[model samples]
Target chain A: MTETSHAIRIEDRDDPRIAAYRDVRERDLIGRQGCFIAEGEVVLRVLLGGARFDLDSILIAANRLDGLQPLLASVPRHVPVYAAASPVMDAVVGFHIHRGILAVGRIGAPLMADDLLTSLPPRALVLALVGIANHDNMGGIFRNAAAFGVNAVFLDDTSCDPLYRKAVRVSVGGCLKIPFARIGSAEVLVDALAAHGVAAYALSPSGTTDLSDLVPAAQSALLLGAEGPGLPHEVLQRAHTVRISMADGFDSLNVATSSGIALHALRAKSFPLT
Target chain B: MTETSHAIRIEDRDDPRIAAYRDVRERDLIGRQGCFIAEGEVVLRVLLGGARFDLDSILIAANRLDGLQPLLASVPRHVPVYAAASPVMDAVVGFHIHRGILAVGRIGAPLMADDLLTSLPPRALVLALVGIANHDNMGGIFRNAAAFGVNAVFLDDTSCDPLYRKAVRVSVGGCLKIPFARIGSAEVLVDALAAHGVAAYALSPSGTTDLSDLVPAAQSALLLGAEGPGLPHEVLQRAHTVRISMADGFDSLNVATSSGIALHALRAKSFPLT
Candidate 1:
């Protein structure tokens, strides 16, 4: 049973309190005033469970509140919980939300790339990305990073915002859980990583050592680029080049897949197969 | 300059010759009559470069024809090439044709799972998939197979058709080049592989042996399931249960990424770590 005291029933789709949730696809692009939308039960749980992001409000379909009772109970009573009928919810969002759970949260203060790097504990694994503009790939990378224990993600400007709605959903709330900050250009990011005593490996189709042969340093970062252009030439020159040792003629693997494989390989560095 | 002899200009979007290329997104669902559309330049090149699929026709935008001259010259004279103005091309497809190159080809005769097994050379690697409904995942799997030298791919009946347009596009033409066949159910497919002296391994999070520790036989097949409800319980029981040994309290890696890592590990088995 939902705690009715904390809930506000919304009969009007145009209610002012729920304005942040209206026309979500468009608002995702223009209306993000330092606040981002967390969709689905899992992401909402992540937003409320952690102190990293402050919950602004939650707009949930009436039917879904019953199923989400346990999760809702966990939400701080001070936060507003707005409930809408399923049809009104669809009209407000301009599309049918199959998941039917949504929350708005302030992303908190800006985290500088340097601060993110400084925060990493020794013997950390980091995923450094350049030109990863595709939302799905970014989300997948974050999900992989969390699964394989990446300490944090450092992104160049060319990469998409991990806080983007689609990316948050695709990450399975990983973007919310994992710590990430957009640094400057690829060069600046790598230089900062080096300054912090983190060795970086640029993952490419052409590299000196097979990915399986990479021996991770006490602090390691795997530099990745978008699919087509791959890492810039200068960036590859700056870091140790690593290849996955694929068959001669085939094209390179997807960046997200390659990163996952590379992270797993590097993580295995500490284990040293007996 | 485009070769003018074989090219027919299409002023009308409704030109019957270009019928196969109309409203592709919808037609992909109900109208794939043993034939499929290949989108973009690279996939079109792969479609023409290989004989496994017969070219039914070629459609090109007037502007793009010049750059695709060499590719067009390679097409058999009997295969008619249709050219439309950019606007006509867009109207025909019901969406902007960004790459502006498309081809339709017959998928060729059906190959049975047993036939695919018998056709493999000695010391082969096969990727057997169950419930792989996502097109992008299917495409990524095929690309990985091509990269790591997977001899062929076997899919259970529940898996989506690899010839779906999105799957082909995502594969970056791997679907065109790599040989795949849908064999009955998961049990039947695994049984056939066992009969062929091929060792089968089901990848799961709870497997007994770490993926890094598995030894590959002369002929090996890695069985993978869809993301949510991994390979069925009975199937895991029958095969040697193998896992990637992920970090504690994290989800399993993406199915496509898992397959790539598993394939790489088995591929490395022949070169055991010293």
Candidate 2:
């Protein structure tokens, strides 16, 4: 780690400066002020890209310094890189973090819904998430959102924070690459998109139109919600309701799967599915 | 609760006959013999449908018996219905199962891939999984497979068991609805589909053809592998290589997302994308 000569060596679990990374599970319950944790090698690499969040600091197991040295080049010089042994890392985290990689990054001022919708290009496929609280579902939806070439993402205020540690990990850092904003409600987000000429296709088990029958516009957004209760009835009433055909009524697709399928359907159509 | 008068109360955790319900986390390691546990009320209802496997027994928190009574009517009279207090149930399962629902059932004889493939209808969409070891991916893939009207699922020998507790729960018992079988290798599964006049499309990040361009056949199969390694080269060579267009090279879709998107693409094409 010769290139990282300025790295700080964390010798004790009581280091007050590294407080943000302590007892993450407990800290997750209460807010992290304006800081969020990014874990594992992949997310750290994306964080080092410095595109989305500003890095506060990074901490990795001492043994990993050599392996990660190449990727650490882009990390800003002033941001402290804390290296600790596995024992200290485990002690501070309050669990055996097998990944042995962690980074603290500052969340920027929250993006507002209407301002974000107005800024997108005329040709865009947006993904609007509403009331999706499960971290895994949030991560999976964002992962698909990025992969399917979504121009931007809109999450309702009720949605789980995509920056939650597990969401970041599950998204494989894909969430970091995409621009996202949250609004007051699903209605506000959907209405804002409409004002910007983005057609909303709300997914539901009882949707009137099969996804295949729905034509994709130049600007379209697939509106999604949590698994069980699904999109709010009022929200579904406003947007064009669409559904993926299933084998039977025995089960419905997971919310993330709906995101992938619906986004693909919308994207493929705009590309002129021939 | 009145409808479930047949429920047997379990007060002790050490009863020898209830050994199968003991320490599920430990049992998952050594194997559950032929017995697999289905957790949560949704899965328990699916288990009681009596379509695939016979119900060995059901053990739910005693308080749940009343709530689950309507659904429990499907349980065969011959099968045992065991109800235990929350503490006793947690002690036996070695964890606090907040879902408070579990059912043990035999995993019948394994279905050979060749038999399952050859038995499918002429117009079929099959999902072939190769070297997918993650349980979440396994469950997610199965859940999507069911949603997209996949005719069957084929797992290569190296794939993780979809019946594992977490996978089963993650699948929302959709894995239970889907008829799946394992084969010796990806090569064998792809070749078997070929023999049945099914066109195989292997999904890879660096594939030759875009997914939208690949025409779906009367009988088609989408072959997928793990996220990082992806489909094997030999297997890719055997089938048509297709890739989903992504925003950039920084990230790829999760395998479950890949399955959902690919299956929808294939399914939508046959209905003739308008």
Candidate 3:
């Protein structure tokens, strides 16, 4: 159980050597200031293969270290590997650990809204979160964004941080693959969309215009909001409000689910190959 | 807090008076018998208004009892209400409190596979879960099923109980509204689907037939599996495998998200009325 190559072994929960791994819960409390953690081998591998994110280190359960040896072999030998017994790992994480492996990654700098606009193809679908505070929904949106051909994502200040551990885990590592930016305000986002010549459509269950009626624009940004409250009046006033027609008696679709359907409908009309 | 009309005060968690709310975690243990617990006022109201399910009782935190007074007024005096302090309520439920209300409902008697078939329309889109074990995905399927006009859902033996608390909560109480039945085995479900003149299509991320190309059958059953392992070989062998076309480099969508899109597309073509 002790045979290891490059991974560092630590039996202590308070090891200053693993300071980044300590106070894991506090990381999520700081909002945008904290790092994102990807758990399990599947998500870790996806994050590593994806473009331009800093991997802080990989932690492996002492007994299960061999299970991740092949993954370790692929990465640079200099990358630190923290190995600990299951009990020690549990104590450090402050929870019962199911996934035997964990990887901490630094959140990349936010992209300029204009950069996302120009970088995307002429015909592209983008997801814009106006004030979605639910971390799981934010994660689900990113996952759907990757599934459908969403070129980029823009999160207003009110949206939850997509790089939080729960978001990353819920996204199944899709947050790493999809290009996203955090714009300052809804007004700024609307203006940015205008500058890029991208039609910004707010998705509201009770919107006046039918989403199906709108001919897919060359490039479009779908503005989504939190459930119940929906998009702010100012935000809706600034952009076109479009509704996905649903059968009567149904209240509304979940925000993330609605985004998936909306993105698919948008992509169905004009998915950019380039 | 003591102004009670129908609400009965319960001072002890161990009191037989609250037997319906006892050992909820243990009751939720698979293969063990359990009653369904629905949280939040919104979901509780939805269930009461929409479904024919039996109500056992309602539990509310003492501080929030007044908020639920109107709802209690509508229910029969025979239906007991239990009130406790927030801390006591949390201690009994083994979790922190939110929504400040919980309703226990008796599980409806199991529906026969034939019953679902008889109820289905001529042009129907149904979701058949062959081996989906995740309760969240099961719940998501029901939510999407309701939204997209999936006529009914047939759960195979390998699938988790759709009425599990987590599933019900995640489904946003759609489990109560959506018509579903446990079909015992894949063979029985296949037979029932065939009897209803439904075409059984297994959804795979890498199947031969493109999903867009597959015309909606007079009646269609979209079969989905667990996220990673995918549809069981036997089920796929029995079904017509269809693949959802996606942009290259992205992995498969979460099973629930995939189901949502598949159901939406199929419903549009199959159930034109919806």
RMSD of each: 2.4, 2.7, 3.1
lDDT (tens digit, per residue) of candidate 2 on B157-185: 99999999889888888778788998878
Q: TM-score, chain A, per candidate?
A: 0.95, 0.94, 0.91
- Residue A270 accuracy (lDDT) in model 2: 72
**What TM-score between 0 and 1 does chain B of candidate 3 receive?**
0.89
DockQ of 2: 0.54
- Compared with the true structure, all predictions reach lDDT values of 0.85, 0.84, 0.79
> Model 1: runs farther than 4 Å from truth?
A1-6, A271-274, B1-3, B271-274
Backbone clash pairs for candidate 3 read none
lDDT of 1 at A217: 84
Instruction: Please give the distance, in angstroms, between residue A67's alpha carbon in candidate 3 and its true position after superposition.
Output: 4.7
Who is ahead in TM-score, 1 or 3?
A: 1
Please, what is the TM-score per model? Answer: 0.95, 0.92, 0.90
Ranking by TM-score: 1, 2, 3
- Cα lDDT tens digits, model 1, B202-237, are 998888888777777888889999998999987898
- lDDT at position B53, candidate 3: 77
**Candidate 3 local lDDT, A1-274, one digit each (tens):** 7588787889789998777766677766764354678877767777767556888788878888887777777766656989999999888877766987888777767677778888887677888888888889988998888777578999889888788888888877778888899888888888888888888889987787875566767788899989989998888988889987665665677888888877776666566333
Order candidates by DockQ, high to low: 2, 1, 3
* Angstrom error at residue B166, model 2: 1.2
- After superposing candidate 3 on the true structure, give the runs of residues whose Cα lies further than 4 Å from its correct spot: A1-5, A9-15, A30-34, A62-70, A84-88, A272-274, B1-16, B30-34, B61-78, B81-96
